[model samples]
Target: MNKKAIWAIIGLMSAAVIGVVVLQMDLIRTAVKVNEERFEKNVFAALNTVVRRLEAEENREVFQHSINGFVTAYYEEHDNTGEGKPEFTLDYSGEDGRPMLSPKLSHSSLLDELMAEFANPCTCSQCMARKDNTYRSLMVYFQQNTREFPLEQRIKLQHINGVLKQELGNRGIDTDFNYGVFSREKKSFIIVDGHYVVEDAQPKEILPGYRNIYNSRYKVDLFPEDMPSPGLLMIHFPARTSFVWRSLWLNFLGSIFFTTIILFSFAYTIHVIFRQKKLSEMKTDFIN
Candidate 1:
């Protein structure tokens, strides 16, 4: 190929790469920001309902049942089984004058109580560990098929970043927490993605008070009688999307694609520049 043509190709390739990178970065950032806001609002809304119900009932037993039910329902509905069954079955007296099961919380009294208790803080360590009500609320919210705020309606990127930074700082931790939010584009979806490890300076100790509350709240023996201390709280912060491939592999592939495009473009540009200089010298020789 002629020197000019080679140079042109190199220039075009470089421009193309720069364009793709700039565009992708912006799109992903926007997507991540939009998703984060959607998560905050939607998750909070679900949690608010639970809080209101909890406070209204003030019955520790019933409140525990509702909260646990919501959590169970969330996991069950999102289960790998692919069964589209309702998680919480409402038990009540039917027209047949017998008890029946349905996927409805017909007991408004129970729901009302749950909502109320949810409104008030449980005054426990884990709950008090974080200051924000929204995050705390998310720790225990449950509802299904509600209209979520549009991506635009979500919080701004700066705001989200600020809140997270502040929350982490308050906990005496330093780490970049990358969050993304997306919806299944279908009715009632559950997604799990994005994970990072948090290192604890102190030995993993589930404070007695916190463990007791979690035990009562979830009805699960999270702390076994056998082990003294679990030694770590694995914070599995979820993403709005499911990963089709492992994250490490995905990242590796992306890096390779980006690097190849840049390196090839640079090498091609250098080759074209030298070729052009050579051609110009030959033209000079011919003219002399």
Candidate 2:
């Protein structure tokens, strides 16, 4: 090929290599962005799961308390009356202040009466009103008795750690994490990892390495229905960025390897073209 043709081939090869490099960079960038978003999504989901589990635990306790109260009231009425048949009144006082039943029965009879009264009911106004009154009173009782303990007493650091680790691991994220429960009422962190931050104390100053715990990207409300103000659960992963990038290392290395090979081939091809051109000129001179 002539000099012009040889230079044209070199320019085209250079442009191809540059384009390949740009494309590879863009692909890596896009991959990193996608991985970051996936990581965030998983973390948020895990936080929500933790919050829900905590709420369920509290609800279970409240329900158990309500059942015990109901059973105790039944026995008390029976003992006071000193009769085989006792009148039981379920007076769950709330805003409505409506009386559900004043039945003359025994414990077993009461259960049967309750079933007969509430279950297999027709669409009558009286039955519907009774159902609505019963539901509202129970809800009021639950709301009134829920979360009687303080935030610190209700939540344990070990439980939080265990649940968070399990939930995050379930979502394929296992990393060293720092978590804190910030009490909105106290306006400070009640607990952070292994230590408890006192009211009005600076968490950053108290826990040097756990500075990010308060400003964590992953956060959810703890006991949202807690009176006055609800607490916040915040989690920060120190090694999250490294962990996310680790997954893309192989792709990055492979791209680099292939790109290197392409450049090497291009260089060798140019070198061979120049060498042939030099040899052709020498042969022409010798022939002249």
**Which prediction has the highest lDDT against the true structure?**
2
Q: What lDDT tens digits, residue by residue, belong to model 1 across residues 72-149?
A: 775576575775544344332444322233455434344453345446667875434332443333333311111123
Q: Rate the local accuracy (lDDT) of all candidates.
A: 0.41, 0.77
Per-residue C-alpha lDDT of model 2 across residues 167-248, encoded as one tens digit per residue: 9999999878888887776667788885776754443343555568876778888876555447899998889889889899
Off by over 4 Å in 1: 1-11, 59-256, 259-263, 276-288
Q: CA lDDT of 2 in candidate 2?
A: 89
Q: Which whole-number lDDT from 0 to 100 does residue 258 have in model 2?
A: 100
**Per-candidate TM-score against the hidden true structure:** 0.30, 0.76
Candidate 1, lDDT over the whole model: 0.41
The local lDDT score (0 to 100) that residue 81 gets in candidate 2 is 86
